[model samples]
Target chain A: MAVRAVVRRSFYQDSMVLMSVAARLRGQPGVREAAALMGTPANHALLAAAGLASPEVKGAAPGDLVLVVDAESEAAAAAALEAAGAMLEERSRASGVLRRPRTLEAALAARPDANLAVISVPGAYAALEARTALRGGLHVFLFSDNVSLADEVELKRLAAARGLLCMGPDCGTAYLGGIGLGFANVVPRGRIGCVAASGTGLQAVVSQLAALGEGISHGIGVGGRDLSAEVGGTMTTLALAALARDPRTEAIVVISKPPSAAALPALESAIRATGKPVVVCCLGAASSGAPGTWVSTLDDAADAAAALLRGVSWSPRAFSDPDSVRARLAALGPARGTIRGLYTGGTLAHEARLLLEPLLGATGHRILDLGADEFTVGRPHPMLDPDARAAQVREAARDRDVGVVLLDVVLGRGTHPNPAGVVARAVRDARETAARAGRGLLAVASVVGTDADPQGRRHQVEELRAAGVEVLPSNAQAARFVALALRPELALALLGPR
Target chain B: MTLDAGLDQPLRVVNVGLELFAEQIEAQGAAVDRVDWRPPAGGPDIASLLARLED
Candidate 1:
């Protein structure tokens, strides 16, 4: 094996372009790992930690662009580097005739009427740009990560004071009015607005809302830590205020991985002030004690929000249909082994773990949030590259202890074009492998998308079902389905046939 | 005074980094100005730069 590095001197490019170029290189023959990153100190540290930092990569200037490939041979390394160069050129060239400015000040100068600044720079510099935009009277959509909590607090404070929205530092999705920002899905425009601390959680809820014939008016991403003890739900509070004032939103959904104990009061108070029907899906927390209807899963949050909008009485159920659960278990022969959840959405993965642990107690299950930093080191998120997680589904077939394979397909703008097809092919391959071993591999999945999504939610669901994968109605249902399959005794008790 | 006031107006954006974001907004008929952002000229004294920007 060999390592090679190329530093494009002082040539900066967007992280998405770099990630795509790197993804292309990873697909190249004999390439072990590929990273295309700007030459910043933080990136340098990441390369060093990953053992990919050559002296050249380490010595790169912050303004430089670094492309590194770890490959099978010297020839392979060099070839991948050349490929990276070409991919970067092709992608960066896609920038159209829009005037490009070097500084935010210059950008605002040209378009003084610009009310928003979408910042996706490296984390070391994300706060700086976000602050600049806020000071210049632009609501910020910060799509960068690795920003310090201190910086996030300061930036949110400034935005709050100026009555502006600062969407994220690690925030990945938001839809303001009809415009999709960051990695958002093509959801239907309707009356429900969302303020999310989890991007994919927001996606799951909004997509499910659309599935329920209720759509979002606006989806505000408050990064993943807006409700942390340190941040004190500053942005979430601000977003709540904004959503309250918006006439288009008749109801609201707020999603997070449960707020910090200290942050919950203020957050709940903000929700109360919205004077709107709110459904809170703060995963892992039983009840936020807020005025809004508190739910455990993103699916329930959407359901509750839809019901609120309809002025009908509603509460979450174990399964939307209980008869189907019993039928699914009976067909699978109540196979009981280790449950493996291979997921692309981090929040979805978290939900799976939350659902499975109570059921699989004493016994075991493995849930991999493949979108975590460990899995997505130099590569794009598994959302953008479905083949990675899809390929993992096949690995389950080889392991006899693997009882059921759980998966999630997230359909959105910044995601893979045909994630369902990719997973469907892998499910077939895994099933074949399992069949060869005279074993049954129960593949369960949830598609987080709406009919209006670019990938066509209904079509994606059909694709998964066609491959013999039990396409559960929601991520919560899919995870719970694995639990019921592994312990069929639990199914009769948890979800009785109607 | 809040985001609602701006939501009614056609979204005008100054997008820094990722031309694709600008393109996505444009595809939805919103106006976006792209910034070919680089680290500020003297490389980056990140902490100091953040302090200056905040001020």
Candidate 2:
């Protein structure tokens, strides 16, 4: 195999665009691995670590954009590079507009009444832009990543002092006044407001709420690291204050894993101060009650919020229907004991781990978050790329001790247009790979979306089911089903019928 | 003083970074303008800039 690199000077594209372009290159025959990134220092490091950096890439200026391809042969490498160039050119022409402004000052000058600034630059520059935006009297929706913790702290502090919202440095999703941003779903305007530290977690809950004929007034994304000890949930506290005072939001939902000890007290207090009913889904946090409702999962968080607004009682949904669990276990016969979970959503994966560890033992289950840094250093998120998880599916199928391969398919705006279809092909192939070896691999999966999402939940589930995957109702249910496949006795005892 | 004070108002935005963000805002039927923003000279050093802007 050979490697090739293409460098374009003085060009730029956001991370997701480059990731999508690279995904296209990987789909080409003979392409082994591909990455399309700007020539920033961190991106340079990512390329070097991935073994895709060449002399040209090593010498590239931060203004340059780079595309690297590792292919089966010189001709294939050349073809992939040519295809990548065409993709970039097509993208540029597609956005063909007149001369655009190049600074925040110019933008505000053009539109003096502008109150919000959505920042989506490289991480090295994100904090700087956010600072400028905040100084210019704009609330910031920071959509970049790789920002230092110190930068996040300073930016959030500055925004708070100015009485403005600074949504994210890695904030993936938010909805304001019915406007969706960065992988958000389509939900109607209603009374419940949401503040979340996890992107897909927000999507899962809001989509569920929409499914239950409920809607959200606002959805604030505090970047994934907001609740860390250093950040101390500064933005979360501020967001809670903002949502609490918003008259349109009669109920509120806060979704995240249990926050740092230093941040939780203040966070809980802020929630209580809202004076409105609150639904807290701090997964892994001990269940709590009173002025607020505590939910163990994202689905229950939505239910709690809906119940608060509708004046109904709330209860957590069972992981799965008992009859279905028994039927699945009976179908598995005498299978291998290990379960492999490949997840694109980190919190969902963490939740599955929390559910499975006590039953299967931590080492017994392999629940991999493909969106984690180790897995996504230079690649697109599994939600967008699907290649990494697909490869893992094959790996799981090949493992002699693995009988069940679990998955979570998240669909919405800014995600792959057809994530289930992309994954379905791999699911079928992995089952075939296992069957050829005279072994059985049960693919258990769940869809985190609603019928209202761009990729309809019904269709995505149908596609996965057609590929022979057991499509369960939720991620927790999927994990429980995998547990049942591994150890029926333990699964029956722990996850009895609801 | 409260975000509620502004919740009933029509959305107006100054998207200083990505065009997709502005596009999404417009798609939502709100008014938005894009700012082709880049890192300031001296590369994201906002201490002095923030001091000057706030003052």
Candidate 3:
């Protein structure tokens, strides 16, 4: 194979944009591999490890953008690099002639009254930017990931010392004063507020709230590590206190993947101190919830929050229409192989694993988080590029032991405009591929969205249904439906006449 | 810090890095200004930025 590398000095782009561009280059004809990353030590090390480090890379300054391509021929490699260059040029052209401030200080000078700084730089510099913002008397919404635990702790402490909030180093969802950030849904303003450690977890609950005719006051994301032992629930506690003090937030909801042993007590204490009715969804964990109601699923969290706001009692339901679900599964006949779950949302995938393990055990069920680093290291998030999950669906179809395929389609701003429509094509292709081998594939999915979402919930759901997928109302229900489809007799016995 | 009592002052946002976040805010009918931010070295050099910050 031939390898080519080019370094463009002082050329800057956000990490996500470079990652997506590199992924696109890899898909070109005759390309073996492609990478577009900043010339940081870590990224340079990555290039060396990939065996594509050339003399150009060695000579590159730390501030340069290194583009490398490994292809079957020298001509192919050069052509792909040119194509990548064209893509970057096109982006520059599309941005128009408006000048943008290069430094935070300059930006602040331009907008001195700005209250929050949304930081999405690379993980290495994320904490530095966050620290600058906090010191400048601005709350920070950090959207970068891969930051060190020590930096996260220090940043949160600094924010707390200044009586400000440090939302995340990997946060992807939040809403403040009717403004949505990261991957968020458009919902009406209401009395219920949320503080979550999960991005899609926050989106799922808020979408459910909007569906139930309740809305959100503010949805704060404290990043995934906020509840970890190292971070000690620093931001979670702070966010809870902030929400509790907000006069418009009549009720508060907190979501996470169950806090660490050391952090749980403090979180529970913070909840009790709030003096507001709190609903907590710790994903799959079984906790006493102490001062607040502990729900099992993201959907349940929203239900509880809505009920609290409306001053009504609410309970979790297995499925919206059990009879219909059972009838549909009963017709699908006996499933012969294992259930394979392809998910775009990491938390949703974890929730599926939690729900499926007791019934199918560790060996019988397999769930893949398509959004994980392993799957998205040099590619766009699965929510933006469906190619990764689509490829996985085809792989599952070829596996004779795979009987049921489950998926989660998350919709909102900053996500694919036609997620359901895109996944529908994959579902159709996979089923057709499986049928050609005389094997049956039962596809199940849950679309996390609302009617108010730009993707149009009804339209997305109808698209999935039309593609032969059994569309459930929520991720948990979709998991349950998959369980019933794969082992109808056992699942029915467990439910006991439903 | 005291939480704002309600939806205060039409929600002016300062997006430090990602334009997408600001776009989402704008789509929600809020005022948003993105910083088109770069690293400390005015490039993709996180290593240099981190080294300087450590100083």
lDDT of 3 by residue, A1-498 (tens): 888888988777775678677987898889988888877776777778887677779766556788888899999998899999999888878874147777676777887777788887666667777887787778788877777898999999988787777888778788877777888887788888899898999999999888888888889899988999999999898888888878788898898987899898899899999999999898877766377988998878988888877778898877777778778877877777888899999899999999889877887678988877566543467887777788888889999899889999999888888999888999899999999999999999999987778898999999999999999999998998887776776655544486
- DockQ per model, Cα: 0.61, 0.45, 0.47
Q: Candidate 1 versus the native: TM-score?
A: 0.88
Candidate 2 per-residue lDDT over residues A296-387, each given as its tens digit: 88878887788878888877765536777677667766457578889998888988898888777876668888877566544455776777
Show how many residue pairs clash in every candidate, following the order shown: 0, 0, 0
Runs off by more than 4 Å, candidate 1: A1-6, A19-59, A66-99, A396-400, A433-438, B1-6, B40-54
Where's the lowest-lDDT run of ten residues in candidate 1 chain A? Answer: A91-100
Q: Model 1, A306-419: lDDT tens per residue?
A: 887788998678888888777877877776679888988789989888888887873668899887766764456788777678778988889989978999999977677899
- DockQ score of the complex predicted as candidate 2: 0.45
For each candidate in the order shown, give its overall lDDT on alpha carbons.
0.83, 0.79, 0.82
2 or 3, greater by lDDT: 3
Question: Candidate 1 or 3, higher DockQ?
Answer: 1
Give candidate 3 regions above 4 Å deviation: A1-6, A19-54, A66-87, A93-98, A491-498, B1-10, B39-55
Q: How close is candidate 3 to the true structure, as a TM-score?
A: 0.89
